[model samples]
Target: MNKNIILIGFMGTGKSSLGRRLARRLGYKFVDTDSAIEEITGKTVEQIFRKDGEIRFRSEEKLLVRKLSGQSGLVVATGGGMVLEQENVDLLKQNGVLICLRAEPEVILKRVKNKKRRPLLSRGDLLENIIKLTKERESAYEIADFSVDTSRLTFDEVLNQIRKFLQQEGYIK
Candidate 1:
């Protein structure tokens, strides 16, 4: 697993969970880009959004990706909106096998329903925002090398699918 396995997805799509498990299985480092940003800035993602606004948070995110591009043997779980920008995708893909995890809007809502940390879902209407954001990001996500819909699958199933993808892509033995 020389190339990083970069997981890109909407907020509730299991990028972080799967990335952590994949990293453990492969004995590679696991990095959640959002957590990295929070660590670097000394502020939570919601704080960044509330205090400085999303543009600033995205700027921080871009910087993080730029830094991560120079490293190796890590599974990167990107923030939901990371793929919204083409340049982010380009930089991450330069040394990573980018895979997008996917799920239905309803499924996503169900998963994130109780997660108050999601800044994007701070709006009053959860389901509506999920539908709108999913539509907005679908095209960008389509650029991934492969897609895994974890809406119904267990984590083990998701892991198997990702393992198979990595093996077929020659990233793993």
Candidate 2:
């Protein structure tokens, strides 16, 4: 199997941006799983959450991950909560080098603040909700093959760091 580069992290951790940069640098295809889902389901993420709820969204997310797992030479940016599903994690591991982009809560809060698109954070208690979600999801994040702190790094910096890590870990030449 061709090893893929899979980016997993909380929302606002720069997965999509870094994934795009990394794919460009590495000459690979870029796949944003969230966008794929949006296209396939013909609904925005907020709409999916409001209409079908998180459980249904997650199920669809897992299905997309499974479908993408067989592809080669792709850099995939996954939804923040995608790794929470064990099946998704397993499928990602089978086909990719899982990289976790982590950031301080404050950094994430700053990056995501006033983001109207995110269904989960479209409430008053933004910081509190981020803290709660981070606490609940940290364990899943820890399962990543590599983790990078993106709190202070620019998008290019983070992409370079991931490239170095991949090379060191022999995922890339």
Task: Choose the strongest candidate by TM-score.
Answer: 1
Candidate 1's C-alpha runs over 4 A off are none
For each candidate, what is the lDDT? 0.93, 0.90
Clashing pairs in 1: none
Per-residue CA lDDT of model 1 for 21-76, tens digit only, reads 99999999999999999999999999999999999999999999999999999999
Candidate 2 lDDT by residue in tens digits, 9-122: 999999998888888888999999989999999998999999999998998998898799878899999999999989999999887999999998899999899677799888
TM-score per candidate:
0.98, 0.96
Best candidate according to lDDT: 1
Lowest-lDDT window of 10 residues in candidate 2? Answer: 114-123
